[model samples]
Target: MSFFNLFTQKSSSKISDKKLKEMLESSTPPLLIDVRTPEEYSRGHISKSKNIPVQNFEDSIKKMGLKLDSPIVVYCQSGMRASQASKILNKLGFEEIYNLGGIGNWSYGLKR
Candidate 1:
């Protein structure tokens, strides 16, 4: 692989839309988190995703009592906050963390 390719390789935490769709359709789906403001989430969000603003990420996550090995998928308005939340999850010892980038990337129907 080229040097640039090595540096630009996608992280394992990155999940494609197709893969995400499959996961959501499966019997056991990952926990989907929208790391945006409550107001933003209230306007529109991916169906079944829980609103957990990145600012209150840790506290909310801790309160949920999720197991460390639980699969979690995070997203934001434009991907940045999702990335931030992924890092926090990693630091908090979460084993399966997937970043679904931005909500804009989701092709499925959303809930308002």
Candidate 2:
């Protein structure tokens, strides 16, 4: 399936950056993930976002000890990696996965 198709197939799997910002303010915040490389993440990232490079996402998620249904939002330098990561998360049984597209599309600012 196309990357966009994945989001369209599941209502909970794709969220705009603006919506993600709003969701971050909720009482129960979703887990924010940066699916870029460690170096890319170190340069800058959303505050409170965990860096889990897409190449090692599965193992990283396993090490995180999160529940299968935990709410999660993933982003990358561009949308491609994030979409791939989101699909991986879905296959891993994460029910509330949100592909927040690219960090470049995030207008709220970043934390270096």
Residue 106 CA displacement from its true place in model 2, Å? 0.5
Candidate 2 lowest-lDDT run of ten: 4-13
- Candidate 2 has an lDDT of 0.86
Model 1: ten consecutive residues of lowest lDDT: 3-12
Give the top-scoring candidate (lDDT).
1
**RMSD, candidate 1, Å:** 6.3
Expressed as tens digits, the lDDT of each residue in 28-102 for candidate 1 is 999999999999999999888999999999999999999978899999999999999998887777778999899
TM-score of 2: 0.86
| Model 1 clashing-pair count | 0
- The lDDT for every candidate, in the order shown, is 0.88, 0.86
